[model samples]
Each structure stands twice: as C-alpha cells, then as structure tokens.
Target: MSLAQPAPTPSRWLRAALPAMFILLGVIYATWASRLPAIRDLRVLDAATLGTILLGGGLGAVLSFPLAAWLLAHYGARRAALYAGLGLLFGLPLLGVLPNWWLLFAGVFVLGAASSCFDVAINAIGAEQEREAGRSIMSMLHAWFCVGTFSGALVGSAAAGLGLSPLWHFLLVAFVLLLMLICAYRILPCDAPDPDAGKKHFALPHGALIWLGLIAFLGAISEGSLTDWISLYLTDHLHASEAGAPLGYAAFAGAMLVARLVGDRLKDRFGARRLVAGSSLLAAVGLGVAIAAPSFGVAVIGFVLTGLGVAAVFPCLFSAAGREGPTALAGVATLGYSGSLMGPPLMGYAIHGYGYVFGMALLAVVSVFVAVAAMRARLLV
Candidate 1:
C-alpha cells in the first residue's frame, strides 16, 4: 500500500466508526417509526391525516437522494456522511417538539431528508471502505444496522409499554445518538475530492447497473412486504393469537439478522451472484409455502426461509453498485429505498382488495423474478 492509497486496509477507527454510524442511523429511524401511533394519538389526527403527514418523509427522501449523489461526488463520502449526520442530530429533537400541523409536516420532512442523506452517505462510505479493504464487510456492517434497529425498537417498545412520554423518549434517544455521532466524527478517516468527478453530477444507471438496481428493488420490496404484512397475515389469515402474531415477523427478522451476520463467509464460498439468485429462489419457496400451507407452524417456517433467503441481497447488490460508480450506486440505492418505503402501502392495498394471502403470493412471484434476473445479470462481484 502506498502513502496515497486510501489508508490501506481501513483503520481500526474506521472499521468501528462505520458500524457505529449504521447503528445510530438504525436506532434513530426505528425509534421514530415505533412512536408513530403515539404521535398520531397525541395530535388527534385521523388515519388519513396521519398518513399524509407520514408521506412527508417519503417525499423528502426521494427529493434529496440526487443531492446526496452530488455531495458524495463533490465532497466525498466522509464529509457527505458528516453533513448528513448533523441533519439527524438536529432533526431528532425537532420531531419531539412539533406542535402544529405545518410544524409536524416540516419536522417529518426534515427528519426524512436527514435520514435519506445519512442513508446514502453511510452506504457510500461502507462500499468505499469495503473496496479499500479488498473483501466483503458490507453484510457485517448491515448486521450492525439490524442490531441497532432491534435494540432501538425494543427500547422504544418498552418505553411505550410503560406509558412514557413520546417527547421525552425521543429527546433522550437523540441525546445518546448525538454522542455516538460525535465520537464517530472524531475518529473516522477524512475524505478527499474525487479527481474523476467531472462536470457530470449524476448518471441514471444503465446497462448492468440497471439490472443491479432492479434486483435491489425486488429484494427491498420483498423484505418490506414481509415486515408490513406478516403480523396482519398471521392474525387475520392464520388465526394466530394476538400476542403471537408478531412472532412471524420476529422469525423473519431474526433469520435475516443471522444470515447477514454470516453472509460474508457464505459469499466467499458460493459467490455473490449465486448466493443472490439461489437465495431469491429460497425466499420464493418460503413465500410459496406461506401462501399454500396457511398454518401457524408453516407460516413461521416460511418467514424464516424468506428472511434467510434475502438476507445477503442488499449488501451484495450494493457491492456491485460500488463497482458501477458512486453516482450509479446512488441511483440504485435511491430506487431500492423508494421501493422499501412504497412497498408496504402497496402490499396493504392488495391485501385490502384481495386478501393477505394474495399479497404474500404477489411477493412470491416477485422473488422468482428476482432469481431469474439475478441469474442473468453480470455483477461486478
């Protein structure tokens, strides 16, 4: 490694800080999401009004991703992450204090924008650092994200169960996250401008890059659909106990977490494309069982299979995106994130019209398509 070769092998500080950033982002976003019902009740808003308010975040995410690409190209991933991290720090407290409709709208929008910026920047950093290190660490980094989500959601869920104030709960979580961000900023490696960054600011992903994006889209929507619909399907369609309905999703998430933690080794053995295509089929089969069996035991098994199946997908796809160029990766990630955000509602509408079984079946169909696509694509990895 030369003196100018991007800090050979990634410093220990960077390895630690990158995952910490992921944890912080996950905790912040999950904590906020878990408290939405409380926020709705406090504001005395109907479902429609609340839905509109939540849409602010989605709108903000879509609008800012292109800007995130520009920032990554011009300022580099580290600075991009730092700037976006500030958005998270400031936005967390604002979410707690919004008292009026307009303020609520603005608050969510800001928080959404901040989260999206951080999402883009941090993933860019993860991909950058992984390339510099010459191996597969994206899954490990993403596992920390899952860990943070679980930790934060558990804490928030416990707090809510205890009837804690949402405002106070949010503020405390924000304070802790703020501290984490400061430490990460202090120790992580700095960034330099991309010499290759020319007059071009953004490039819509084409060729193999578009295939990667499509795969990301499918994987994300499948994951999102499972999270949103699992509980409802379990209780409504499968007749699981109220307390037990959540176990289906718990199974799914837990399996995915475990798979991601071990995914790097599996990728080393099987290769990413094989892992992706094979897992997509596994996920499809699991979802097929959920559609066919319609029993509690089978449902749990299905969820587990689905989770394990797609666990390595996002990290794998993102790794391929990195090879395609940062701008192209940005486009790919934006599309994937958008699918995650939109997939739940779309699945919900389908469930409403036909049935929960129909929705799961739809995802099963999509998973098969992803498998076919994954088989065809020429991935960089």
Candidate 2:
C-alpha cells in the first residue's frame, strides 16, 4: 500500500478501527494521569519525588525515538501500532500494582515508550487513510482522542468519588480497552514495511519541517502547561473553592473538543496557514486574559477561548508532516513530544522563582510567537 497511489477502498471495519486506536490511546494515557494524585498519596511521595517519577515517562519517550522509527520502518504501521498498544495496555495495570515509587517509575517509563511508539504508528495509519480517502480526516481522528480523554476523565472522577481503588479502576479500563483492540486488530489495514525507510533510525526536522516542529513545540507547551497548572492557578490566584478548580481545565478541554469537531472542515475551507495564524493569535489573547483574570469565571472564559483557538494546530501540522512521509512525521512527533516533556517542569521552576502569573505570562508570549510563525510558514498548507 504505497502512499503515492490511491489505496484500495479501505474496509468499513478498518476505517472504524483506525479512529478507535486514537481513542484507546487517549483513554490509557488519561486514565493513568488522572490517578496521579492518588498514587502520590498512596506512596506518601513529596512534590519533588513525584516530579522525578513523572520525568521518567518523558525520558522514556525521548529514548524511544530511534526505536519507534525502526519499528515503523520494519514492521509497518499496523504491526507497530498493535505491538505498542499491547505494551501500553500491559503497562497501565502495572502502574496500579507497583509496590513503590521506583517500580512505579519503571512502569511509567515502559508506558511512555509504548505511547510514543504507538503514537507514531497510529498517526502513520491516519495519514495513509486520509490520503486514500482523498480528504482530511486527521482532525476528526484526533477529536476522537479528545473524546476518549473526556470519557476517561469522567470515569476516573466516578471511580474516585466511589472510593474505588486505582488498581481496580485501571484493571477495568485496561480490560475493556484490550477487548476493543482485539476486535479492531482483525480489520486494520495491511501495508508492507517500507524498504526505503529502513536506513534512518532517527530524524530531525529540516527545511520547512523545522518550522512545523517549532509550531508543534510552542503549541505543546501551551497545552501541557494548562493541563499541569490550571487547577493550581484557579485555586491559588482566584481563590476558587476546592470543588470548582477542575472546571478551569474542563472549560479548556470542552472548548478544544468543540473546536476539533469542526476543525477539518475549517481547514479545507480556509487553508492551514490562515487558520493556524488566526487561531494562534486567539490563543495568545485568551491566555493573556486568563493569566490576568480577576475572577475564576473570567479565567474559565479565557481558557475556553484558548482551547478554541489552539485546537486546529496539531491536526493540521501532523497532516502536513504526513505528506512529507513517515520520517518527517516521526521527526515532528519527536519534537512535539519533547515539548510536552519539558514544558511543565520548566514552568514549575519559573513559577517557583518568579510567580504563577509570570510563568503563565511566558506561555502567552509563546502563543503569540506561534501566531507569528504560522503566518510565515508557507509549507503548512
């Protein structure tokens, strides 16, 4: 199944299964993340210790770049995605059963590696599917990921509310996801491994790809910072009550969900460069407003705007990179993953030294930079 030729009409089951992979990926990731506080409390770990544990996941991802490229080159997307997905499912339950922080770090490391590998492969499949269909579907596929995250978050909240143990929650989710994967695998598209892709074990963004990576980096920082800090910001800055703090993130996520639901059509109608530039500018403004907001309600409004503004950047960027071939997409994904790894910790240090407002202000500044870069990036189409 060479991408240069229009692929055979994919089976309906294959098309359905492809999006399911993205959703399952999100469910696994969020299910683990939403349980972080619980795990910390269980182990009686301090902030620094928890941060160290989290760092393991990032390191694992970075280290897996070469391996991910190799897997995609040798095994192709279907086998690579399946193998990595199994690793993810296995790692999830391990996190729940780990006896200590060190073991937990090891589990998270495996999970992260699996996630990075799975991400690259699944996205490769999406790129292929989009090309075969002669349309843009990456945004809608990514939207399903958001759906999974939202669903996973809700499930986590319910489990927590019910006082269900993390072990039980994870086990249940993993079991269900595994069943879904089993069904999906039966119908996933088959492609022979790319012989040409074998020589490159790793990649760095070059030429126009460098700009695409830059956009991904800044966008990731903005997204990651909000996920990591929004609740704390609402609680500390606005004096939001305990029960209300999570709503800030909810507003952001919900807005992103809505934006992505419409993102593909918007991309087709307006072109990637124009849409990205305008949306990034909106994100900058929204983040600035949120950082300076006098009240919680105002902050939530800002977050909503930020979400709406930044939603289309990745799907567009990923689709563009996919056009460049597997290596390019892998390179962009690697760079973007690095930003996700570095953003929160860097912001933590900044906030500790300066203040919360200072840290968030930096994110807003980057959002503006994203806007400017998008306008100048001609190849983003």
Top candidate (TM-score) = 2
**What's each prediction's TM-score?**
0.83, 0.89
lDDT (10s digit) by residue, model 1, range 92-208: 777777887678877877876777778888888888888898999989988887777667656766676677777888888988888888778666676876666666656666877
User: Ten consecutive residues with minimal summed lDDT in candidate 2?
Assistant: 1-10
Clashes of 1: 0
- Clashing residue pairs for model 2: none
Q: What does the lDDT read for residue 79 in candidate 2?
A: 82
- Give the Cα lDDT of each candidate: 0.76, 0.79
For all the candidates, what are their Cα RMSDs to the real structure? Answer: 4.6, 4.0
